[model samples]
Target chain A: MTAILLISSALFCAGVYGLLSQRHAVGVLIAIELMINAANLLLVGFGWRTGGAFGQSFALFTMAIAVAEVVVGLALILLMYRSRGDVQVDQATELAQ
Target chain B: MNPLISAALVALGLPAALALLLAVVPKLRRTGKPAALLSILGSLLALSAAGWLAATWLHDPKQVLDLTTSWLPQSGKSMSQVGVHLDGISVSMLLVVAIVASCVQLFSLGYLSDEPAPALGRYYAYQSLFLFSMNLLVLAPDLMQLFLGWELVGATSYLLIGFWFTRPAAGKAALKAFVVTKFADSGLILALITLVAWTGSFSWNATLPAGGAEWLALFLFIAVMGKSAQFPLHIWLPDAMQGPTPVSALLHAATMVAAGVYLIVRADPIFAAAPHVRLFMTDLGAITALFAALIAMVQTDIKKVLAYSTCSQLGYMISGLGAGSLMGGYFHLTTHAFFKALLFLAAGAVIHAVHSNELSDMGGLWRKLKFTTVAFVIGSLSLAGLPGLSGFYSKDLILEAVHESGNPLALGLLMATAGLTAFYMTRTVVKAFFGKPSHAAEHAHGPGPSMTIPLLILLVPAIGLGWLAGPMSKLYGRSYAFHLDTIGMVTIALGLGGIALGWLIYGMGLLQALPRAFAPIARIANGSTVDDLWALSYSKLGMGLARAIAWFDRYIIDGLMNFLGWLFMWSGQRVRTLQTGNVQDYLYAVFGAAALIALWGGWR
Candidate 1:
């Protein structure tokens, strides 16, 4: 359980760094999915240690939500790439227009 | 409502309705005939209403009719009222205004016939508006209503005086008349506010606070000095002759100018309490009378001569009122209205024929215009105060009033002014009517019946209105005999002597110009020096003050506003750079702020 927590914490930190440093729209989406999965992993580890199914069930629901979020996120990135002819989020800077 | 009140309402309302109709209906406003016919019909209706009101008042002279409704209600009572106040004074003034206004409108039809249709329509609209304003003034129940009517008439006078607004001189004269009167009107405004503040009502009969009457009277008299065209302020009036001649007759000579004296009569209770102000009024009136008459003596324009004579005549009315004789002042106002309107309309006829206001361009007009000549002669005779004329009766009463006031100085000045009035009028008659025809007069056309009829109608009152003085006296609850006293006899002799002098110089050509000894007096009376002084004062003092105010506004006031605007704009530009439109940058800021908040909470 301790090892699982360590792994989840490392994964969350890596996701945060990727979100801040990424210039591509798909890269930001993948980083967001990684942070959600890291939280789900911590939930399952806690459930097994406490011998309660409540944490595991919550992790199952979080995983499903993460899957749905990734699908929507990838579709938006695909549309952005089609419009701009590139996946770089930094180039699409004119939010006001 | 009383029948007299209804009559007064009609007298006031018809012209207002006509003016409104002319204003609101574009189709009606563009046609001369409809506007003229409507204006004449409205004025005649107003005249009949006024006549009926006067006759009813004459039937029962003692009854004072006051019918008012709450205009501005406050705390279960009215602060001001709108209604008719028909006493002898107002009724008489109403009749005078009605008569002069109707005659002037009739005469304007012919006088302005040559104008384009739209311009003619505008002229009649203004005339109807003037009539309404004058009648409203005559019928006002309180100082508030009076001031409203007063300003309305002033505005209408401005519009009418600059009726031919295409002419630069007409526009300037109108502006001069408006600004000068408006400056004096500040006194009236102060008096009204003070009266309302102290007494809590705008009624003329409101009991004033301690020592309020004198100041109020003095303030009202200051306004009178401007409206009545008294000395110094008399400058605007002669210039106002730049308007059409009928405008001069109605506004300057008869109704609007007499409003000052009428105000004194209406607010007699206040004026009666202020003896020092009355004395000031007497001395000022006397000086204005002599001064304006002296100026009238040298004027080359027929209308200018009449304009100055109006100032002189107004002085007599003011002096009579100042001497505590309402009968003298008001009766003179009645008679003067008729003869002066007659004179101005007759002058209009001559000007109409010759197509010029200059006396140099008019001569031998009597041969071409017989009816107009006769009318002009009768008007001039009445104005000269010849025995058995309307001017004789009214002028005698004023002199008698001044004599009784024990102001020998005022009496002397008025008597001399009477002589000068005759002299200038006779000089005008001889120069314009009797001398050899000028080049313009040789081919002069005669006025149509539209012009001739009003002159003929006004001639009756100009000749015979004096005989009604005894009956007119009853309206004021006084007795006036028709007998000539010693003072009356002396005034008549001086008048005849002035006529003789005028005839000898101009008629007989005994003198080519005024004697060299009188050059300085002539130069001063010619008005150049006084006019120049006024111009200099206005350009130097008035314009200088305006410039300083403008500078303060542009720099000090505007600078503060500009600084506030610049601060907002500069801060907005600095704040706007945060919006780099990068998604990762916004995400970094949100995470950083949340982390800092969580760290602070944990530490606490």
Candidate 2:
């Protein structure tokens, strides 16, 4: 259980760093999915160790939310690629000072 | 309905209705003849009503025909009445006002007939309005209603004076007259306020205590001085001759100037309650009488001479009232109205034919304009107060009143002023009627019967109204008398001596060289310096104050507002950079804020 928690924390830290510093749209979406999967791994590990049906049901709910997130992220990336011929976040700064 | 009320309705309502019709109806306004006829008929109806009221008053001396109805019936706190009081004094004033008004309207048929239709219509409209206001003033029972009539007359005077608005001089003169009188009107307004506050009433019958009454009397006297053209306010009258001749006859000579005397007589109890105010009025009247007569002696314009004489004669009436003889003052007002109106209308005819107002341009017109010359001579003789004329009876009475008051200084000044009146009028007549044919007067001709008939009618009063003095005095509650005493003889001698002197100088050319001797005195009497002083104080000083106020508003008041606006713009520009609409930057800001909040929550 301790090892699983360490792995999930590291994934969440990487996701946050990517959200703030990544210049590519696809990289940002992959990082977001990584954070969601890390949360799902933590929930499933806790459920198996505690031996409760409630924790397992909550882990299932997290998996469903992750699925919806990936679906919306891929659609946005496809639109960006079609409009600009490249899915880069830096090129979308039309409101720059 | 009372007959008195019916008289008042005719006197007040007829002219107002006619004025409204002439103003609103395009058909009436398109023709001069119909307007003149309407004005004449309205005045004639009013005159008959006044005649009927006078007859009724004669039958019963104690009969006070008063009609009052609430003016502001909806007022929960106070109610004022708008009505008429038909007493002996009011009846007499009504009679004089109507007679003069009708005569002037009749004469306007010839005087203004040559003008275009619209201008003639406008003149008759204003004339009707003036008649209504004057009659209302005479008949008003309360001070408030009297003030309404007062202000209306002043407005009508302005409109009539500036009737020929194409002339810049006429417009300026109108404005000057209005401003000067309005300044005095402020004093009247203040007096009304004080009186109302002290007694809670605006009726002339409200008896005030001694101290309050004195202040009110002083304020009222100041207004009277302005309206009557006394002393410093006398400057506007000579310039007011820029109006048509009929207007001069109606407003300046016959009725409007007399209003001041009428007011003081109406408010005699207030003035009597303060002896000092009466004495002050006497001194002011005497000084104005002397100075205005002096000015009249030197004027070159024909109308200016008559205008100054009007002022001087009004001074005599005021002095009579001031010296404690209301009977004598109002008596002179009645007689003066006839002769002065006659003089002005006759002069209008001469000026119309000669096409000039200059005495120098009016020589040798007597033969060509025979009827007008005869009428003018009757007016001039009466004005000089010759024995047996109407002016003789009234002027003699005023002098006797001053003498009886025991104020030797006022008496002497008034007597000398009377002599000066004779001198100046005789000089004017001699220069404008009896000399060799002037270039301007060479083609002068007689006016039509529309003008000559009014002069003929006024001649009866000018020559014979003095006999009515005894009966009129009795009506005013004074004893009737027709005897001539020492003062009367001296005044007559002085008057005759003045006419003889003027005859020697101008009529006989005995004093053709006298102008050289009188040059130094003439310079002061011409009054250019007095005119300059008044213009400087009233106009230039007012302009200077206005400019200073404008400067302060522009700099100090505007500067603070401008600085606040600049500061707002500067701070707004600095805050605008934070509104960068990039989605990535907003998301980064939100995530950074969330991280900081989580760290703070853990520490707590």
Candidate 3:
């Protein structure tokens, strides 16, 4: 369980760093996906330790949501690139100060 | 409702309704004939109602009618009321107003005939409003209602005096009259506030605090001096002649100027309590009388001559009242109303005929306007206090009152004023009617029946109203008899002598340069020095204080407001820096705030 947690924490930290530093819209989506996978890993580990399928079921639901979110996120990035010839998220800030 | 109340209501309401109709209805206002007809009809109805009220009073002169309802009620305290108070004074004033107002409206039809339809309609509307305001003042039961009516009449006077607002002189005259009277009205307002604060009532009969009566009387007389056009404040009346002649007739003769005397008579109890103020009123009246008559003697404009005469004649009435003779003052007011209105209307006809107000433009007018000449001569004779005319009777009574008051100086000044009144009037008549025809006078035309009929109607009162003095005296609950006493005989002599002296100077042309001897006096009388003095004080004192107040308002007061605005703007500028338009920065700050909140909650 401790090894599973350590790997999950490392993945979540990498996702946070990528989300803050990335300028491209696709890079941000990839970083978000990494964070969700890290949470799923922790959930599965906890379920196995408790000797039940409750946590594993939750992880399955989470994976399905993540798949739907990634599809929507990629579509938005494609529309932005078509409109502006670029998908750099920072340059797409129309509502910024 | 009582029948008398119903009559009073009609007398007051008809004109108010007509004024409203003529003012608000675009169609009626645009059409001259309908608006004039409506105004005349309203005035006649009010006249009949006033006649009815007078008849009721004559039937029982001793019976007083006071009907009031609570207007501003306060529990266990005195409240203001709205209603009528009909006594000898109010009823008499009502009849005079009704008669004069009706005559003036009728006269206006011809006097203002040359005006455009809309202008004529507007004129009649103002006339109706004036009638309503004067009647309201006559019928007021308390000082509060009286003040309301007083202010209304003053406003109407302003409107009427500036009726020809296209004329710059008329506009300025109206402003001058309004400001002078309003300045005096502050005294009245102060008296009213003090009266109410101390006595808790606005009734004339309210018991005043110690020494309050003198102050109130002094204040009231100050207002009278302004409204009645006494001495220094009288500068407006002559200038107010820039209005249409009929408006000048109504203002000078019966309504606006007479309201002051009526106020004095109505508030008799207060004046009676303040003997010192009464004496002051007598001396002031005497001075105004002689002063205005002196000025009248030198005026080149016919209307200005009559305007100054009005101020002089008003002085006589005021002097009479100040001498504690109600019958003398009020009776003179009644008689003066008829003859002065007659004289003004006659002058209006002459002006209408020659198309000029200057005396130089009018000579041998009698040959052209025969009936008007006759009317003018009679009015002039009455104004000069010829024997057996209405003016003689009233003027004698005032002189007698002054004589009885033991003010030898006032009596002497009044006597001199009577002679001057005769002299100036004779000079006017001789210059305007008897000399060779000027170019305008040669081509002059006579007034139509609309103008002549009012003159003919007023002629009766101007000639014979004096015979009713005994009955009028009875109305005041006093006994009076018409007799040519020593004072009466002396006044008649002075009047005739003045006429003779005027004939010698202007009529016979024996002493043409005699007037030149008095030119210095005339120059002083005609000078604008008094007016300039008032203006100077206003600029130096009133404007200076206003400037200080304005500076304080702009700097000190506005500085605090601007400081508050700056504080809010500075704080807003600091807070706006948080919005950098970067999603990453906003997210970081939000997450940091959430973590801090979570840690604090965990510690708690």
Candidate 4:
């Protein structure tokens, strides 16, 4: 159990760093999926220890959200690539000007 | 119900109707002679009506005819009424106003007939309006009606005084007259408010409330002083001579100036209730009479001399009213009307002939204008209170009243003022008529019959009105016999002495001018410095105050408003920068806030 916890913590930290620093649009989307799965693993682990089904249910809910997020994110990247011919995460910040 | 009532109404209504018709009818408004003729006809109708009312009132002094109709319908309170109260005083006032107005209009027909200006229609219209307002002023039953009439007369006088608006002096003089009278008019407003608040009624029949009765009397007296040209307020009348000559005769000398005296006589009960107020009025009257008389002596302009004399005579009437003799005051007001109007009209005729107002430019006109000379001499005699003249009868009564009131100071000042009146008038006559021909007088000619007729008609009243003093005194519900009282003797001697002194000086050239010892005192009394001070206070001081207020409003009030506006604008601009329209930046901010919150929660 301790080993699993250590691995999941490392995964969450790596996912947060990638999500913030990634320059490519698809790379950022993959980092968000990684972060969501890491959260789901933590939820399942805690649920098994606490002898409750609540954590497993929440993990299920998070997994479904992760799938929906990837779908919308890929669509955004497709739109950006079609418009600019290069889907860079920095180029998506038309909001900043 | 009463014939006098209808006569009074006609006296009040005819002039108003004609003025309205002339003003509203564009066709009638375009013509000059027709307007003058209509005005004269209306004034004559008013004269006949006023004459009938006077004759009726004279037959029975106690008869008071009140005619009223509901003016404003109110739900809770009893409604106010449009009304006229025809009594002895009102009848007498109406008669004097009508007679004088009739003569002035007749004279104006000639004065304006030859005038090259095309605006004579407006001139006659204003004259008619003035007559209407004055008649309304005399006949009004309530304080409200009196005030309305008072203000109407003031406005009409303003219009007439500025009739020749092309001249700068005429315009300035009109403004000065209006402003000064308006300042005094506020006193009437205050008096009305006080009367209404205290007595709960605006009727003249309402006895004044007891608590602030003296203050109310003072307010009314202040209004009278302003209208009558008492001491401090006499400054306007001399300047108001810039108006047309007939206007000066009708309004300034005959009616409007006397309106103040008429008010005191009408509101006698109120003044009687406040002895201190009466004393104050007496002092003001005495000071104005003496001061104006002295000023009249120094004036070089013929009309200015008459203007000051009118002021002095009005002072006599006011002082008489203050001294508790309604008969004396009203009688003087009546007689003064005739002589003063006569004097002004005669002066107008002389000016007409010589085409000048300065005494320096008028001399030896007696030979050229024989009828005007006779009229002027008779008017002068009446004014100087020579025995058996109208002014003697009235001036003696005023002196006796002041003496009987036991105000030694007022009596002395008034008697001395009487002497001064004679001196100045005699000096004016000598300088203008008896001396060698001046450059202007060299080309002098007699005025036409239209002018001469009014003068001749007024001369009869100026001479014979003194004998009517016995009968006229009875109009005030008192039987006064003609007798030379001690004060009467003193005024008589002083009047003769004044004329003798003037004859020795100007007629015979016995002295160069008023004694050299009088130079400094004359300089002070001549009103140059006082006039400057008056001009400065109203113009310079008033402007300074207004500018200071404007500065405060701009810097202090507007500064606060602008500062708040600027603060809102600056903060809005700063807050707008946060809305950078960047989706990534917004997401970053949300996540950073969420992370900070999570960290704080874990620590807790």
List the DockQ of the predictions in order. Answer: 0.44, 0.36, 0.28, 0.32
lDDT of 4 by residue, B330-381 (tens): 9999899999999999999999888889999998999998888888988998
- Candidate 2 - CAPRI tier? acceptable
| Top of the candidates by DockQ | 1
Best by TM-score: 4
What is the per-residue lDDT of model 2 for residues A1-97, given as tens digits with 9 covering 90 to 100?
Answer: 8999999888887887887678888788887888887888888888888887877799889888888988888898898799878877867765754
Q: Which structure is stronger by lDDT: 2 or 4?
A: 2
Which one wins by TM-score: 3 or 4? 4
True contacts kept of 3: 0.33
Docking class of 1: acceptable
- After superposition, which runs of candidate 3 have C-alpha atoms over 4 Å from their true positions? A1-97, B76-78, B555-604
Q: By the DockQ metric, which is better: model 2 or model 4?
A: 2
The number of clashing residue pairs in model 2 is: 0
RMSD in angstroms between candidate 3 and the native structure over all alpha carbons: 5.5
Candidate 1 residues lying further than 4 Å off, grouped into runs, are A1-97, B512-515, B560-604
> Per-prediction TM-score, please?
0.81, 0.89, 0.81, 0.91
lDDT of 4 at B161: 92
DockQ of 4: 0.32
Q: Ten-residue segment with the worst summed lDDT in candidate 3 chain B?
A: B579-588
Instruction: Tell me the lDDT of model 3 at A29.
Output: 92
Candidate 2 displacement at residue B488 in angstroms: 4.0
Model 2 regions more than 4 Å off: A1-18, A21-93, B403-409, B480-490, B511-572, B584-604
Sorted by DockQ, highest first, which candidate order results? Answer: 1, 2, 4, 3
